[model samples]
Target chain A: MVTETDIEKLALLARVALSEQEKEKLRTDVEAILEYVSDIRKVSGGEERAVPSLVNVMREDGTPHEGGVHTETLLSLAPKREGQYVRVKKIL
Target chain B: MSINLSELTIATARRHLANGDFTAVELAQSYLAEIEKKNKNLNAYREVFDDVLEQAKGADKKLPNFRTSKLPNLCGIPIALKDVIMLAGKRAGACSKILEGYVSPYDATAVSKLKVAGAIFLGRTNMDEFAMGSSTENYAYGVTKNPFDESRVAGGSSGGSAAAVAGNMSLAALGSDTGGSVRQPASLCGVVGLKPTYGSVSRFGLMAMSSSLDVIGPFTKTVEDAELLFDAIKGKDPMDSTSVEVSSSKLQVKSLRIGIPTMIRETEGIDPDVRKNFEDCLKQFRDAGHTVKEIELPTMHYALPVYYVIMPAEVSTNLARFDGVKYGLHVSGKNLLEDYVQTRGTGFGMEARRRILLGTYVLSSGYYDAYYAQAVRVRAKIEQELRDVFAGVDCIATPTSPTPAFKIGEKADDPLQMYLADIFTVVANIAGIPAISIPSGTAMREGKQLPLGLQLMAAHGREDVLFEAGKEFEKLRDNRGGV
Candidate 1:
């Protein structure tokens, strides 16, 4: 039931360029994979009993502490940093 | 007898350390030498701490009390840590170019606990970038090869840790399990990998990946070794809100009900040998006086879809901090968004980008409710099913993987195929249950020997069951002693 367009969209979303041959290979392979997942769908009902382990994990209110991150560590991850914060390209 | 010192479990190591059989300095140096020799081919480590000898030397002086059995269980053992864990003033990049050259100012809580336990910090093992892939192939450093066969993957995002243990480069290593990142690779590499119940181990120091599912565990050579490592590092931490202080029942294995999933046998692509070995294990359990029963967990089928949606959604949120303006590899551009995209596009490897994109899409405004929200509901259903199953069963058993280790690049070309590597292992994560992989038998790959593992999963907070069952199985396997 999967189409080339569907695969193409997925690829674009995933940012992997696929050639004609690659797409062809994926058509069969992905279909099989999807079929496997679809079988999983059967094992877990579509929506009836679907529930997650993490539920409303709320925390008590507390006074905010100053972020303990070393400025050097924070700035180090940035391509560029200003005095107090990371510098980014001007969007406006 | 000298070599025996290195092979000793943490428990035995502590005993010897107390008796002055060896100093911590000697233990650290021996492991360092072994790692240097074996790691050249395995590519298991990203960085070996230069201060290990100094740390060991200090420990040697304080060994008096530790030798007296009054100290923590890990006083003299050398435990390797995965690179994703924060270590004070040490590089802790989760094996990604984005976080290259980054060092943490503070130690991860687990690392701090292990340090306080008098454990030696060996080094950081490699991992999939941001803990994304099934094989260490996704690591920017390079793929970690299986210890048994260099041509095959060690199974990942904890591949490096598993390899370090299997290759005997470290006595024990810490690994994180989001979706079998620890257990699957442990299975493939023929080592013991434990994924503790969610909140059993604090995650204050681990790099975030699907926070709902992530838990820190160990990769070791034996079940007792795993328990030794787990005992030292597991406890509730004030920093990690999710962690709880639930002490497990120290019950022995003789009085337990082992459950095997009847529905899992119906899963497609399971290798016949793995299936047979799992059955053999069940039979052994029966012979050992443990009752084994078949149970139904119908909600398990939706695990993959729920995983795809929820994991991606969480990944998208967790990875948002790696913008170009932050502390990793970044590219600059005229516009902020352009800079962000280019930095991520360039810094992240293919697998990371793939997962990030999938996450972004699933959590995108338009698709959030339909895909991500629905997946959360599905996850709850899966959890509910687990509660139902656990009410009747003490632990569940399955083959860790559909098959044993595959060739290095066999499934690397296809992401979906690679994702399936964690399929059997993922259910444990989704339900926040504890699981462990132990060596069962050997599988032949292109005429080379490969080890297959049988995984046992237990209800939340019941790691004791896994250790009990694993110990019995180990005894049985030792008795059999065959190819």
Candidate 2:
């Protein structure tokens, strides 16, 4: 029941480009998987948001480690870094 | 004198190091030599730590004081990481093209614990790219072939960790399981794997695949070795809010009640030899004075469907961090949106992209109620059912995987068939309970004897129940006199 437009929109939302061939193949594969997992729709409602084990785990905002301990190391992992910051394509 | 890895467990390794029978450097070298001999074809390791011998030398310095002083269980033991678990200053790519050469800035909590216990890092093993697929075929580098038969896949996404242990490249290893990533690979590779209770082990440095289901586990030659590694790495951490203080209850009783879900008989594509092996193993327990009975879990059939909905939703969210700018592969385009689109498109493998798109669709505005929300409610229902079942039985049992190691390219083309491989093991992850896979017996496939695994699941925080049952099963299996 899913349309090609749905597939293209999903790809856009997910921010993944697809070749025409890849789009066709992915559309087919996702259709089959969706059909299989659609069985989840069969079971009715329990309390919504009633995840039995989930608890709100909040902690005070504080420095768990000394500042600057990993600043350099983390920046160093950037695919494209200029001095202290990660470089990205210009939007404007 | 040669090192007999088959005879060495963590317990014996500690004794040998304390007595100076062989230095830690020597043990590390033996494993490195084995990796060098086998890795070319098996592709078990993505990268072996260059400083392994140096780490072993540090362990050697601590050996002299160990005779009189109490030493940690994992000291001087060489272990492998499943690449998804970060080791500070080493490359961990999760076998994905996107993060291929990205180095970890800090150690995973589990890795830090192993370091404190003085375990030597042998290497980072290969895995499914972003831990997406059941077969190692999704790896960007290459597939990790089964150590038993090179033509077959070493089950994944922790395939390399399992293969390294089974192939004798390391004594013990760590892998993260979100479904059957640890136990399924262990089943295929003929080793022991343990998936501890969700939140019992911190996921601080293990890359997120499915946040609700992800747990760090151990792959080892024996169940005892698995327990040794589990003990060292399991604890609450300040960095991870979801991490829990693991207090394994002392299992006081010997005669245990084990439940075999009757729905397994209806599991599609289950090999006959696997079924026979499972029945035979159940008979062993029955003969040994433990009660084995069939239990009906009506909701069991829904586990896989639920997993697909939840896992992809989490995957799309977690991997959103890997755009062009931050970590690894960057593809330039006219502007920002195109940059992200092209980078992710080229960076991810086919399976990753499929899951990502599927996840996006399910969580999309119109479809959210039908797929994602309903799946969460059903997940809670499934957990409640399991909790009720655990009231009567100490553990639930099943074949770790429905079949023996499949051919390398056998199920690669069809993603759904590949997901079926995880049918038996995913329930444990779904319920956030502890599960273990132990080598049961071998099945003949194409005239080769491929090993199978028997899985045991216990209630949450009851890994002790699994370990006790696992050890007993191992003893019974060894004493079967080759029936």
Candidate 3:
């Protein structure tokens, strides 16, 4: 069973803040979902089968690339923009 | 003759435009009028494009030289796109606040292809936030009501696209199906929805939900229109390396063996009306001289549980991109870490947050092997079982959804119950196979008729079989005078 502490740790790891009420609700919801999916442990056994279609896809290292047409468009979408760059909070 | 937009299919509309019977601008205007009348109650389209007539006017000029100019099949067709798809310079938010005011930088490969085909996009439709929930209720904007019955949900996360096509606001619409996002809503809204085989269509522009399971498909009023849209959009794309080129052969209905999962019907939660409709569909298949056999798929019971584990894990990882600095909702906090917390916590809806938390819990240190790894192994088992079953049968049939469209707040409180709404449709995604949900009949509920869909699953890369079966099933339904 997941406790409030576990929920808190998960919220921290997930980088999402939860209120006391939301955290308590998540604790119950997550616990119920985990208990339900625990059936996977009972059914899954032996060696894992290889999924054939999941092959490593690679592109040539030195292909000429077209410049993105939407640099201005993308920059305009940023919440806080300064000229051509997106502005963010100071870190250090 | 004045055209009734409500009766227009992509196929019929194309012929009318080709023959100069109507201009694309007129066609678009008809749909715009319909959207104006119905969008208030249905909540299908998030934004109707202001330049729809301008785009249609371009198509009208191009329609005259089609034969010599090598115009595409979808030329001059007006269509709707689910909000999750990116169209350069347009807002593609997946119905979430985090992505509010965010404009796409480039066209999704599918969108680019549709544009190249001279298809006029009418607008972007609403959907569940990040395509996370079974109903469109998870939307930060508003829930899309079923066009047939306003009180019930249009099955989601492509609910808006389904509603748009069902309400005749657009000829056809593009929808991305991750765990039945396309098919369930299509079923609920009484339209045709196809989820092509994994990697069949490029996902370069679609907002990632569960990357492994997300396949962009179409919602149309007819199977033939779905085929046209699928053909126009499907191909290998360099931007999406997972896409592969697969050749298809014609499917012969006379020689087809349709497998019915007897065990699935015996499973709980299926409504009696849905079962009867399914049985009626089978009887129609039999009357049409096709064989239906009961097949046991024991792993079917475990699909929902496996999906819940695997999908949320992928969702958690995929959604990490919305950190708020670059393109979406950005909130300032004391520090960088707190910035992410506040932005996401405030931006995401309850369903999205719950899934993110569940995903984080499963992928966390101690529980990775217990939940995530185990779920993968079982997923492989399910895939293998489906492969073995396909060797013996041409296609497998099941109810697209357990019941008709449920009331809006019916399953809202219980997340688990809401997840169960996709129970019958997720198996195709998990196994990387093609599935189509076509309207079989309608069931009566609360003095109103709600649509029920029959789902058909085919082997990987065999969407041809699905289309063939779907076309035949549609014919049988029409013969019986059933919508």
Query: Which scores higher on TM-score, 1 or 2?
Result: 2
lDDT of 3 by residue, B1-483 (tens): 598876788888888888889888888888999999999999999999888999998988878778466555677798899999999878888888898788888899999999888999999998888888878985467889998899999989999999999998889999999999999999999999999999989999999999889999999999998988989999899899899886767786565689998767577999998999999999998888888998878787788899999999998999888898987888888988889999999888888889998898889888898888888888888888889999899999999999899999898888889988988898999998999999999998888989999999999999999989899999999989968
lDDT of 2 by residue, B80-180 (tens): 99989989889888888898669998899999999888899999998899898888886468899999899999999999999999999999899999999
Query: What is each candidate's DockQ, to 2 decimals?
Result: 0.33, 0.79, 0.74
What is candidate 1's lDDT per residue for B1-483, written digit by digit as tens?
A: 275633577767777778878888888888888888989899999888999999998788778866566545577678889988888888888998878767786888999998888888889998888898888885468889998889989998899999988887888899999999999989999888999999989999799988989999998888998888888888888788889775768755465688878767788888887878788878877887788999997777677767876786788678777775657776765566656666776777766655665676666677676666667667777787888988887888888888887778898778788887887898999888899999888877778888888899987888888888788788888777832
TM-score of chain B of 3: 0.98
lDDT measured at residue A45 in model 3 versus the true structure, 0 to 100:
52
Fill in the DockQ of model 3: 0.74
Order candidates by lDDT, high to low.
2, 3, 1
Report the alpha-carbon TM-score of model 1 versus the true structure: 0.90
Identify the candidate with maximal DockQ.
2
Cα error, residue B202 of model 1, in Å, equals 1.3
Backbone clashes counted, model 1: 17
TM-score of chain B taken alone, candidate 2: 0.98
Worst 10 residues of 3 chain A by lDDT: A44-53
- In angstroms, the error of model 2 at B54 is 0.6
Better of 1 and 3 by TM-score: 3
Ranked candidates (DockQ, high to low): 2, 3, 1
Residue-by-residue lDDT tens digits, candidate 2, A4-61: 8888999999999889888888888899999999997888657567645567788888
Please give each candidate's TM-score. Answer: 0.90, 0.98, 0.97
